[model samples]
Target chain A: MKTRKADPKGVMTGAHYLDGDFALAEGALAAGCRFFAGYPITPSTETAERFSERIPFVGGMFIQMEDEIASIAALIGASWSGKKVMTVTSGPGFSLMMENIGLAAMQEVPLVIANVQRGGPSTGLPTLTGQQDMMQARWGSHGDYRIIALSPDSPQECFDLTIQAFNLAELYRVPVFIMTDECVGHMHEKVVIPPADEIDLVERKWYEGPKDAYRPYKPDTDLVPFMIKTGDGYRFHTTGLTHDERGYPVINAEVQDWCVRHLIDKIDKNAEKIIKLEEEQVDGAEVVVLSYGITSRVAIKAVQDARRQGIKVGTIRLLTVWPFPEKRVQELAGKVKAMVMPEINMGQVVKELERSVAGRTKVVSVPHCGGGVHDPDVILKAIKEAVK
Target chain B: MSPEAKNPIENFLRMDRIPHIWCSGCGIGTVVSSFADALEKSRLDLDKVAIVSGIGCTGRVAGYVKLDSFHTTHGRAIPFATGLKLGNPELKVVVFSGDGDIFGIGGNHFIHACRRNMDLVVICVNNFNYAMTGGQVAPTSPEKANLSTAPYGNFEYPFNVPYLAEACGATYVARWTVLHMRQVTTSILEALNHKGLSLIEVITPCVTLYARRNRLGDGLNLLKYYYENSEVRHGADTRTLDIRFQEKITCGKFIDVEKPTFLDCMNTHLTKTLGEKFRPYGV
Candidate 1:
């Protein structure tokens, strides 16, 4: 294992080992993974296969369940049992998993789900990469509540974002999605696997009092419940329906409003703390380039190339997609006269950008369908036109 | 574990989801009561047990139980409980579903779940008809049995749950009607405590539906048939029970075979295939 060489401040240094997927996955194991359950689907299958191969060798459990529902259901059970758990699936499988994903949402089970998005609605373009699930990742699960989602633009981000997914899931006790398109998921890029001492590991919060006092579903002041694992000798209820502080089913209108709004507020209030973005050369730029996931890689390159030709174009890559990062965009949206958004789908983030910018900047989308990535030239042209 | 005073059944009940949706004079209530009695007698910790229910009148098993229970989508409880058990090798998970729910719409899941030999217990209440949705014909309803769907008489061949379970890799299979509450409770607890997929098929009656339609009298009279005509035996042959029950009703702990539950074999083999030492995130 080529480990991450670190300085005094623990800032990351140089690269070693294979590319992003392996490094991030290894980091997850080292960070305390005990269970990995998944269904074999393309682009993301290698991630599942590798985890299946590795999890057992490392004193953990691995299961290739019948379908996506079983896979996620297994993951939630494992997580509830004090295991660092995760599952990986592609677009179609992810669609099947949305119900359980919503269960994880309603039950507040902390876990990681990596979706290597592919094309189309029903088996659209399985082998090809498309960022089509960009919107689905945030809102696919029925009902309103906030969730934390991160998008990775490269192989390194794919690896790094996976660990980040586990960390965020643990931090907030919510399901975390690592939105990686096919380009990012399958690529073999140089990535250093961080050493145990050099990397930070996160564990789920638990009740420190007596087992009797521990409410696996009791809400903290933050509205997040302290969940104790099944074997830990604590009693708590986890319901898919709207629930009370004890986790029992609550059908009353007022309690429903409180639980739903609180679920949203947990993410919303902490948006500033939870959201992460990558901004490049936006200081005194007229046109800003916006994108996320693998599309952001092309986006950054487009903006960088435009800047080389003396055009004042910059880039803002959303590392966190679901929280929306409205404040960051609004502040930067005002400074930039126009913005160009490029993504795999017809148009998703552009709408969010349009909403945040409120017409202060001319917004344009360089849309690409299933087959492949949006060309860098296409994004560059959209930026130049927006600037003009 | 006493039956009435200091009732062992109280240990497994939610005490709140009851009085359940099960109708008065319903056989499901008897089965549920029997389940609690079995659990209490077996002396299993409530925390280690997970009772999962599918959609049906009998699917309320999870709701009434205090253990880690799940009231899942219709016909999907088997898979859901399979996931729960597979993830943790330590827990005893049970699927409590009704005949109409399991053999009718969820027949595929039921057969597949049994075939896997998933380490869990399955307590199925064979009430013959879909009582909750009003008198509807179920897959287990006797040929020529009348229900709303089969008002003229069911031309379809009904399922024999004991034979069904035996064919589907069940390590332990049995049949006991709700009329024999003590025997049914013992069979249920035996299934609960047993490893692998153990299914106890309770030949229950839908008093409100099947009883009213066939004039099987009331719940008391319907239960009377179970008491007088029911047969008890040693090693009740599962293969021949369904065939023999073609003319004669045979109910007992029919098939109890020894097979490694799916969980034990899966974990042990995975560990062996994986070799000596591997723990994902430790030094």
Candidate 2:
């Protein structure tokens, strides 16, 4: 679908020094997100702070809700009111948000959530960085559904991918996640905000048919339904239950099948269009290093050292983590001798890589158990081992 | 039925979705009827009025209403309504849900919303138990009240909802029973006109579960009990309004005073701080 230019009112359009969290906020504003409901969680608080400070000038709204559950619930409510909405949280808050994340997905509310990764099963290292929530981002919410998740390796990419996250959210009517770690979230760097007209934003596909004919969940050809804002005279109803096209609860297996399939297929069938990977020199490499978020930056350094040592190593940095980019990984697995994956978590995303590779070649995991990033030498050794 | 011959409130209901999931003799339907009557009486643009509900039997009110409605997750109607109102200040958002949804699992949100005085009308149908879940113990269940979970009789204390609302800074507070249909309608209409967080707790009957478990007979018997036991005490101190097991219920418009709502405070503060540079949101 064709996209529109960002609303100039929200565009900062300048090069400024910012952390990833602040850049994520700017990116959201540029993407026409006018409503942000979030709670203060370390590593993610700066985004909410930035938003609360900036949104008033943009004619937008920012609310610090009572909790993460209310934060996400508010975002869904705001989204239906025809505003692009988002929230930022850390691990604990993300866990609180899962139930409503499932609500947003099931109701097909376009929402963006940024989980600034921190070390944890439960508030383990609040001030430290870890990519531990990678798998949780995919499967945290219960039931069978698919959501788009993007990882940014830098403050600049934080701005870029957050815009993409909102676009994907609007395009697919799904909850999208900006999965960045505390290292990048707190790391200050130069981020350039381009002119509003240059930045593309996907507006919601709003239904404009006769009010009486409006069916809240009737899918268009894209397997995504058009949405209507509340108080638009459509008088439509939408629920979290397994619902029919009319958005009414239908307690039947057939309706459940349709509802779940609609949620999953909207992303799965469009996976190729949604998956984005930043590849460097993978055309003819014996070993490939796959990584995302802050680990991707670390992996690049390791790949450079391996190349210096005469190993044929390439890098594939995942920009879009969910929808997995499995097909590309499978193809690369066929050509490469092995793939080495490094992540801040012990083994979250590496499992996906191993599954996608499917024993076509060796897949190695260089896991870090939170609080810090992977050392370059550790990833280099994994690359060397994969090739050997 | 022909359009003119049909119920006047039919226009405000999804008539096709009738034969609602509500049980026979359930008071939730009466509350809905009163709500529709209130909507009609208010003369507000129906198009701009939105209804939000949390999970449970009363949560289904959103689906049955012919308005832009949201049946959200359990215990989230207030925050969802908060979002809806803040997202579009022009839209009048009302939260219609049960006592368990609003006060049990969602108590924190409820208190905070009242504290902020978020612009919303919360119609809480307090049936004294988690009716939708087979009369389980709820935060508002009366002491020693029989229920599915509290089969022997509930020993826990129940909340005085109006008292909680008043303590949390609600701009308007009222209570009525489903038997007092006209009073419920009037209170709802008054709530819709109030500028801040207005909470109207409607004591209703859950015949299938709450009433049946307590041997309170059918919904009609419960209504008869309400008619006989309810006391009209306008401006009564909210603290004296708790409904004990089979005891007299104090019902009235106990609190009504104006305070700047959440948005009002936001716009006022931001305008003062940011001056002409501030583009007032949703203005």
TM-score of each prediction: 0.89, 0.99
Cα miss at A276, model 1 (Å)? 0.9
What does candidate 2's lDDT look like per residue over A219-326, in tens digits? 999999999998888888999999999999999999999999989888999999999998989999999888999998888888999999999988898999998989
Reproduced native contacts, each prediction: 0.24, 0.92
List lDDT for all candidates, in order.
0.75, 0.92
- What count of clashes does model 2 give? 0
Model 1, span A1-388: residue lDDT tens: 0123222222233575444455446545655666777888876787776666666555666767777776786677667667778887789999988877877887788888888888987898888889888788889988987778888877767767776787788878899888877777777777765655666656577777876565555667766677676644453546576777756666899988978887788788878988888887789889888888778877777887788888998778889998898988788777888888888889987888889989877889889986698778888888888888
Model 2's C-alpha root-mean-square deviation from the true structure amounts to 1.2
Model 2 misplaced stretches (Cα beyond 4 Å): B1-4
User: How much does candidate 1 score in TM-score?
Assistant: 0.89
Candidate topping lDDT:
2
Docking class of 1: acceptable
Question: Which model scores highest in DockQ?
Answer: 2
| Residues B105-177, model 1: lDDT tens digits | 7686677677778778888888888887998988888887788988898888878788888888888888877
